[model samples]
Target: MTSRQRSAPASILQGVEALLRPLAVFRADLHRNPELSGQERRTAERLARWLGHAGCEVFTGVGGHGVVARLRNGEGPLVLLRAELDALPVREETGLSYASTVTAARPDGRVVPVAHACGHDIHMTCLAGTAELLAANRASWRGTVLLVGQPAEETLTGAAAMLDDGLYQRFGVPDVALAQHVAPLPAGVVAHAPPGEPLTAAGAELRIVIRGRGGHGGMPHLAVDPVVVAASVVLRLRAMAVQERRPGEHVVVTVGALHAGERANVIPDSAVLEAIVRAPSLAAVDRVVEVARRVVEDECLAARCPDPPEFTVVTRVPAGISDPVAAARVRRAHLAVFGAGRVVEVPQGQASEDFPLFGADGRVPTVYWYVGSVPPAVWDRAPGAGPLEKLHSLPAAHSPKFSPDPVATLRAGITALAAGALAWLGTGPLGNGEIMSFGSLP
Candidate 1:
């Protein structure tokens, strides 16, 4: 890109393409050195370093490894672009040369492999690229651009942590907040869920501990077996989702973790189960929790446990609902850049995000959208192979095999963020009115 002022739409488009190689290099660096939630020290440092170099007034360590970059042009709307800085605990299995072989210690003192299975690496790179583009092309748009590098997104606590630490009060209130996620769609395509449909549901993590009397494994009849109780709870939890929830309403109850005895000859004193519940609405999420609590407690009673099963919620992330006006505007901007054929409608996703928390208790309008990450060749070949071998066969986020095309995905992502920012903070010669057609920029 050029530091010289170029207010034309074509100029901005060209600028985004120019940053692709550099952004890919930065993204690969992140992918190779992944960090876990609440521990994104190195990740945040890298972002802060880049933003500072991009002429942004960078603030480091703003809410547990969070970084905020501010670029003030003159006077206009305050637009905030948020991206996560944390990686998942999943081990990388993609066999990519730059795949993560990093590990970090958890609060429990155990170490686990880390990888950017959920594409936070892409999110960070897009934000960085957008920041650099907007900073360099200062003549196009006028406003304050707040770039947020949020940590612990996998745990859904980063947003809340930043807010509680006075994210807006410290920086400034945003008129609009925007974020884009990289998903398993064909590369160069962007997708959005319209109003009444949301990109992600509210999510809650439930930890249940079932207590029991311990004894030799050979003498199960002599002692209460909490493992049996946990098994019952898991089955009933699934049944609650299948048989209890209201028809036409969707919810998912996944028992992601279950633990009991350590040795074959001994029964543990207590069994633990960690369940993740997701629902489109907050009320539905609460209902699932209620049903789960009832099922677990009742099962414990049936198992004749001496103590009640303890149920504790670790975290809850609200549903991410894109503002109608914001979504429409960004969609139009995306169409202008990538054309109508490249922009597609997407179904509501079951995954959860902490991005809604950036709205500051619904005080700000937020638009969170998705950018397709599947390679063009893979997407084209899927259909010829069979229906089952569709784009869905592409390794989705959170999978150990999730590996996004570096250049294609980053280009599409950077384009979406820059175009969306331009849409809201319209172009100008620092003082004139600029119009955006559906296709052309100037």
Candidate 2:
């Protein structure tokens, strides 16, 4: 995040500063002390504490590490705001003095370092500040506001966990849902897609194996090298797009990982390809799988392998659709708060978010938006920093070097998340309307 001296209306800057100033500490705190999915006890506690102090009823540990708060006034429309509290397995390397020093053991007995490389620290901070700002200034609207501190967003389970915990029925279903993500786009710009473009994309994983015979390295013809077969399989996978599908479709099939042989002299018996399939729509995702399966089989047959290799598709994420009406309200709020130039339009994201679970029934309209995080200075400095790291490299989101500009990122998230909730819930001034509270008074 970068800092800029924009000569704008004092009210807009004041609103953002008031919300973000206290919230920046939360970001630094969360960054210095990260927590992994399903293990956000401390994170949840922090959110609850802040929300509790803000005059809203806060409940801790709703689902795993979920925290809920609720505020009410003369009712008109109920709004739900979600904040993710999970961190990634990134070893902090950004020389930021406040980088994560937290570590924990996983179910598999492996201890991993945690960090907020994806800007969720900013998200969680924004959640608290946004809640506080809206709660404090609740005199301007009429309705109930539900603020949720969700867990497991990295693994795409937080939203589902809360709903499964009877969140909707326990208190009441919200008339609108609002969510946002900090993007790699230029800082201070709020990028939003229209009603239909989903902020939470649907995705699945695939385990594709190619098998062959082992032979001496000296004689090429004597052995059935899966390496060769796998190579052709890769080529075929790329070709499928050019040969079978129409150009410009929203589809993505990527092999994230691969594993095989060990020795220089021996021929490996098998090769494994772990892949991910993504699309804005389920039908497109299905088509991606279909193409992948066909390409694998055809390529293996062409390579004269012993038999068709084993292939499996694992469900990873459901497409996250931002409620259309909820999104519009948010967009309008952003414009009102930041003006037109700062509010940009969003396209369907190739990245996936799991917030779609809210719309699993396809009845509720969910609106998701993107907030730019890259500092204009840093971006202007690192011209090579394209949209994101190229496709798949294990070191991506988990890389220790994955640091984003914080000040700008934090402000963008705080403003967007705060304004999004305010518009959805119709929040009023500090002493006037309903506030952003979570759970039943606990």
Query: Which candidate has the highest lDDT of all?
Result: 1
Name the 10 consecutive residues with the lowest summed lDDT in model 1: 433-442
Residue 54 CA displacement from its true place in model 2, Å: 2.6
- Per-residue lDDT tens digits of candidate 1, residues 374-406? 887877766534423475567889999998888
lDDT of 2 by residue, 336-398 (tens): 666666776655767777777766776566667777666676555553433333112223344
TM-score of each: 0.92, 0.77
Scored by TM-score, the top model is: 1
Q: Please, what's the RMSD in Å of model 2?
A: 8.3
- Candidate 2 segments whose C-alpha is farther than 4 A from its true place: 1-16, 19-21, 101-112, 198-200, 207-244, 259-273, 294-312, 316-321, 382-400, 427-442
